[model samples]
Target: MTAVVNVFLKEGVLDPQGKAAHHALDSLGFAGVSDVRIGKQIIINLETEDRATAEAEVKEMCETLLANTVIEDYTIEIN
Candidate 1:
């Protein structure tokens, strides 16, 4: 099983890195680039016979280590 996790900061949080990228884009003459936000993605491969088990484990991983629940949100997809 393959699990893909996308972790990102919640809305209303200040993203300094995103702001820097936005400024850089504007300096390079890219107009109308209003905002930018940065996030992280993690892909995990596991040998599992049950899809539900894999999903539950991945969710636990996200909650425990992959994502910061206090300031971030995550979504997981299994393939």
Candidate 2:
């Protein structure tokens, strides 16, 4: 099985890296963009083929280490 995790900041959180990217884009004449947010994707391979088990394991991984629960949220995809 394969698990895909997307971790991103929650709403109302500050994103300095995103801000820098937005500023750079504007400087490069991409003024149409009003905002930007940065996040991370994690792909993991698992021995179990069951989707439910994979999802549960990945969710635990996210809660324990993959994502900062206080400021970040994550979605898990199993395949």
Give the best candidate by TM-score.
Answer: 2
User: Model 1: per-residue lDDT, tens digit, 1-79?
Assistant: 8999999999998988899999999999999987899999899998996899999999999999999999999999999
**Local distance difference test scores for all models:** 0.94, 0.93
Cα error, candidate 1, residue 73 (Å): 0.4
lDDT of 2: 0.93
Q: Which residue pairs of candidate 1 clash? A: none
lDDT of 1 at 7: 95
Score every model by TM-score.
0.94, 0.95
After best superposition, candidate 2 residue 78: deviation in angstroms? 0.8
Name the runs in model 2 displaced over 4 angstroms. none
Candidate 1's C-alpha runs over 4 A off are none
Collision count for each candidate, in order? 0, 0
